[model samples]
Target: MLTIVKGPYLQWPTEDSMTIMWETSEQASSRADVLMAERIHSGYQGNYKKPEHVVSTVSNKGYCTIHQLTVKNLEPSTIYFYNIYSACEKGEIESGPHPLKTAVRKGEPFSFTVTSETGGYSGFDQSNGRINRNIFHQMQRYRPDLTLFVGDLVNDGQNYDDWEKYFFRPGKDFIINTPFYSCLGNHERNASWYYDFFAYDPPKNYYSFDYGDVHFICLDSTDFIKPEHYPNSAGEISSGNAQYDFLVQDLEATSAAWKIVFFHYPPYISGGYQVEELRKLSPVLEQYGVDVVFNSHTIVYERSHPIRGGQIDENDGIVYIVAGGAGAMPDWFLPKREWHTSQSLAVPHFVQVVVTSNLLELRAIDEEGRLFDALKIRKGTNGRKEFL
Candidate 1:
């Protein structure tokens, strides 16, 4: 079967660099091809021209294959068409003429998409899988600039073949065109397919990138230890000392207008495992003035009020959002805390975030094109706190 998975659009230090990724069924004979073309929008017709080709290699896991392609020296804020293909001695099998756009140069305003909990669910009914597929189709209508996959891209992370059957086949169109970004989910931690297919900076598991005025930090949060083997006090898997140190240095060094962090697990959650193993890193986030935290894994959509020192502090608190509804089925909850301002127990969904000079608007839309939740944060001047 034909499959497609994409993301973790890591921006290289240079203004002209970017990383693109995807996965397929069996390994292709050679590398996949990528073509870029300018976007032309007329009164009633839109066209793409000037195809530029790039090739990508496949990383293998049994019969499954993960593919990655990094394109550099591209113009910022420009739209282009791309595609993937398999080349062999006989001929080439093509995937698409999809489209994507590079991030705007530094200091310019831009928008992107963040989603998670899409495919695969153990113990839950197969209906959960169908819900995720529906959401993926619906999300395409918005045509986001970029897409960040929070985690659990597939239910059986160990089954590379399943990854292809479940995720890639359903989202190929979105994957080929959009510069997708990603993080490791608990499901993904069981195998190396995710890492092998995605081109990340050194130390792979954790890295940071800058786009426009925003600094994006991606972290790995799978608790690898067996639940029965660990003591109650043991925590979730975290970025060892090396990753932590890198984050400290990166955060301190960044001079962007916004600092955003995305990971598989939530530091604070009301269901399906509460509190992250890396709670120790919360202090570092607060100290660095991280503007927002995007998390997944609960299969539910929830957002925390601005919090500081482990408590709600509207003015100086960091906004935490759990966009787990991307495709996974929702979990039952009674809302134990006030931090859960908005939630949806209906269809699976994803989030769309738009950042302007004065405000950051967050919109949660479900598979049916219904608005489930929304919130906004206004930026403050003079380095003081601003409330919604």
Candidate 2:
């Protein structure tokens, strides 16, 4: 049988186009037809204005099993419908007329889901699996435009079977439609699977993207996790290198209305794995006016008061959040750190962020569908912020 093993997921959507990728069990030629939506619908429907198709076929000696197709030349802030067709020996396999919205306009409002350290393989519990299901259903209801998965997607990211069971299979509800942009976690351990499975905007481990008047920096924290041979030495932003330099320059050059950064490690967090040296990022974030920082690894939900230069600065400090409770194990606070205004390991959870020109709204919800915490960040002209 010709089976799609994973994906039909989307990647970053630009003003004029977007990418849709998938993999099948056997080698095959694939094609996808893009159709613009004449009118908005509450759900996916076959009401497309016309069908625009893009096709790909295997060459001479090789059979291609993976497909990444880009649907191009569409209007900004508009939605489109598309279906995938793969030609194989048995028959033509077809899927969807799924709905996808193009990139929002400059000042438009957009929202996305964020979470990390989803439960790994440590002590797989039957009950914990149910928690993961509940959390995913909650996310599905929200229908986030995209999902920012910080790290530790699976307990063992390198093993295909592990991902298939825990991450991909369990997340099928939302993964099919919501494009997941993820960073590396220590547990990934420099696995090639992480790179092969997902597509990056800049096609690098570390990169940035701009959406809806917001500039987002997705950094790699797994660089130094492996001591013997560090796979991502460039992420050692302390010393001058491409990753570090890119981060500095990118933050400096961005004139977006809001700036946010996310990764697997928190520069400022309280836990056994806490590495003080990661604090190197604080000065830079403060210098360039980063509004918030998101991280996951410690398996808890934590939110710090806006901090600048390692000190609580309500007027200008960047708020740091640790939201790693998808399915992985849970952890407790190391101590009552001065920076922590709220901390919880009561349940597994994820964070949802919505941004517009003047405000950034954050809501943390646990697996049981309870609101853990919330913050409303209001911005003034350019550099000013009206703290709440």
Best by lDDT: 2
| Counted clashes in each candidate structure | 10, 4
lDDT tens digits, residue span 8-115, model 2: 778878777777877778887777777654543443353444434432222222346777777777778776676877767855577776777778889999898887
Give one digit per residue, the lDDT tens place, for model 1 in 1-388.
Answer: 4443333222232355455554444554323334555456632114655566553333222333455556666677766555555443444455555555667776566667777866534346456456656667767777766678888887777787666665666666566555667787777754776667566675666788877778899876653333453313244333565566777889989877778999876776666655545556688899998888988877777787787787877777887887876544444444465454434443577888877665777888887888878878777774445755
Assess candidate 2 and give its lDDT.
0.74
Q: Which ten contiguous residues of candidate 1 have the minimum total lDDT?
A: 4-13
User: Which stretches of candidate 2 lie above 4 Å from their native place?
Assistant: 38-62, 119-124, 228-235, 328-331, 343-345
* C-alpha RMSD of each candidate structure in angstroms: 4.6, 3.5
How well does candidate 2 match the true structure in TM-score terms? 0.89
Please provide TM-scores, in order, for all candidate models, with all chains considered together: 0.82, 0.89
Cα lDDT, model 2, residue 120: 47
